[model samples]
Target: MMNHKKILGIVLLVAVSISGLFAAESANTENTVKKSTIIYTIKGNAEETYYTMMDKPIKALGYRLPDPRKHVNQVYKEQYGSTTLEVLSFMTIVNDKKVKPLLEIDPKLAGFNPFNLVIYKHQGKDETVISHLTADAIIEMLGITDQKVITEYRKQMEELDALVAKTFPSAVVSHGTYEGAVENAMMHYEITFDRPEDLDDYIDEIQEKVDDTFTEKGYIMAGFFDYKQGKPDLLPSYDAFWTFSLCHFPYSYTVFDNEGAMPEVAVFAPCTMYMYIKKDTNTLVIGMPRLANWNRFFTMNNSKRMDFLNKLDKDIPATFLEIGAIEVK
Candidate 1:
């Protein structure tokens, strides 16, 4: 027979143990939502090294080094006021042959087809950083579950990493992954437009509308791609397909500059969006990878960031409507 006090003590001990267990479980859940990045830090001037790398061709890597955009000086200064920061948006489309199977399985991969890489440093800083999304991150974000496809993506990524290592032999390559709360990995917005008398004219009209809308909202139209003009054999089977890169510098600066926000988030920068018309169909389809994904994928709990992103998410679809796009319920 136990005393009343002893029984009470036992009950208290059990309650405490249960509480600790729940706390630990919550912590483990948070840890699994992290995202990883591969970072290369160079000791020389960022702009000088960036231009040198850009000028060099990467034929050995199966793609030519495309021209890099000078975003900091050209776009950011106009929006964020003048600053010494220098940022470059470097892109290179993987060999179409290499990504054919993946595309066959999922056409959405085209949104990220020409991979985006970023390099940045303030003029005064002695160190420059080169960063891009890891192949693992891309696969996860793309929601690819096929083990075979995942393996191939990893192989390609490793090859690209090896090349980067060779290019910056002396630079330090490090990794960073976000270990915070995870939210919806991908947010998609889509709308359908009635086919006009002239397809080309309609596309131009939509493009002009997107340009005007995003610009009005303090964003930059970083780049555009006419997929129909790409390799016919390896590309998607769309009758008329196109994609564009859009970036809001101030929004970008807030995320990249904040220590709380994972810098690796830039891997998804300059939002890659798509629009297309199906063969024999008069409907034009337009869509974008939602921008709020930044907070969700990175597990950013900051209320202010979430508020801004929420507004952006709404604004994007609103832009579509403003351009006479009908929401594809």
Candidate 2:
């Protein structure tokens, strides 16, 4: 016959043992059901023969080198949700111009550009998919050649220059413009920056400088405008104004911020200023601004744009962990 205290102790021990057994069984079941992730690593090289056939002028121009380490690494991390699948591509030293021509010639070759696609099982039976493609790929698909593209680009750039001159005949002092090829037309300007923080002080300085040089010039500084903040590094606001001609334009004091993980290569963010000028008592529009991201130009129903986005999503994963070189066998 056991004492009452002994019986109570036995019961407590049995209860604890049973609880421990249940916990172990539950953990084992979870481990058995968890799905294993698969990573695919793909490798390939650009065709050297194709690049060799490029035109002399095109060959002479500096080529955009594909930095496998930075670009590939960054794209993998940014696009894919998991760092599991990795793609490593190499390019043979071929003429720069031939590369674009080769890609343009074949639509199927489009996937050769750095991109990623992800697929996973969802809702018991349904499959979910996502993709991403780099900006380089998008630009190539536009089928824009140097001659076809440069002509329109130069015209817009020149118009912008003329507008600046007409707006600030005296204060303009010295101005210069640079041209480059990006996803869209690119232009750079070097204007006078007298004061640092005080926009009012800068405007006053510009006005005084202009007035002293061109006494009778029809130029006056309009009030400043503020821009809504977007992606921190991509869009930075400084000071903007409307000219006496009623044109709205904004000039940024900060050049570019390169402190973050990714540096902004463009000299200036897309600055669209509306200028209303009086031409014989009627306001004539002068400047039509455009942004660097060409995708925004098309309507939502555009198939090309949709395809581009789809390809991008496929190549790039939705999460950071999915970024990495996968061994594609």
Candidate 3:
């Protein structure tokens, strides 16, 4: 009983609705990029008041806060004679148990194993920002697939997150937005060397050389942690596992503390390079998060900052090769 024109109108209406639905779905997919970093903005500037309190709680979480670089902005202000940052600092913390299961699966997991928990505040701002990478980011970035280990690690992070919330009751939590995971998130390399009669002797000799070499090249040995020696029970299967927090004084100053630069990026600063030697194995593995991650995760768009990022990406591996290590893949 319906007219032909009416039937045609009904068909047109259905087609338009379907098209709109598809368009909406596409837009949502694009907008749903995964977040890789977390930011907590807490009111009040108590300076090192909160920073010093973390030591006890961090130890309770089976983690350690090594080489706490508090008042970094003050150091910048003193050396550079001026600065934009008011409270930019870092506490490179690591949990051995979190990396124990993942380390052998992918030695590169050690790259972010000893990561930074950064605190920053902008000049004239009353709030302090504490930030770090999400556990999801770590699992994805390392290309890890073991769900059991992943779940355990995430839970560990949740415990740490709870500590933050309880410590700063009014902190506003947020995430660092990005397009998603970057390609080749970590830089990994390995070197096969002769097995020595005493492993400690080899470690001592090589460590001294590594320290001297980086220092000569104007790099700061920000901090060092030895899991095999420091926490023997945590690494039951490894002969050696250690991480060095590497920092380029000038580069850090320019990107984080200098005028017109991003201070929040310090969350990834003092890049921790990890190295390990498995039990009775002659191969020594090395890995770290590539500097390229800084630009992609943080969307730092300045040309000068990009140059620093690119140069470090190239320089880090080059330095490893220079220090008698073979590049693995």
- Scored by TM-score, the top model is 3
Off by over 4 Å in 2: 1-70, 73-75, 78-191, 195-293, 297-329
Supply the TM-score for candidate 1.
Answer: 0.73
Model 2 vs. true fold: TM: 0.18
Kindly report which residue pairs in candidate 1 clash with one another. Answer: 34-178, 35-177
Residue-wise lDDT of candidate 1 within 1-329, one digit each (tens)? 99999999999999999999999999897677454678899886666655555554445556543334556444545656654555544454454446656655665665565666677665566887887777766666666678877787788778777877777888898876766543445444454657777677767887888898889988878777766664444344556776777777677766655335334566677777767666657666665666755655565557766777788888877777777677753
Candidate 2 lDDT over residue span 1-329, tens digit each = 99999999999999999999999887675444221111111112212211332223222443322221112323434544323222222221112233333323321222222111111111222221111222222333333355533353334323433432343233212211112222433211124233445445544554454333322322122222211112222112213322211111111101111112111111111222222212122211212112333233222244543454344323222111122112111
Best lDDT goes to which candidate? 3
The model with the greater TM-score, 2 or 3, is: 3
lDDT of 1 at 22: 99
For model 2, the run of ten residues with the poorest summed lDDT: 250-259
Candidate 3, after superposition: displacement of residue 283 in Å?
0.8
Q: Candidate 3 lDDT, tens digit per residue, 37-151? A: 7888988785565665577877888888767887888888888898887787788888776767766665666777678888888888888888899888777777777877688
lDDT winner between candidates 1 and 3: 3
lDDT of 2 at 155: 40
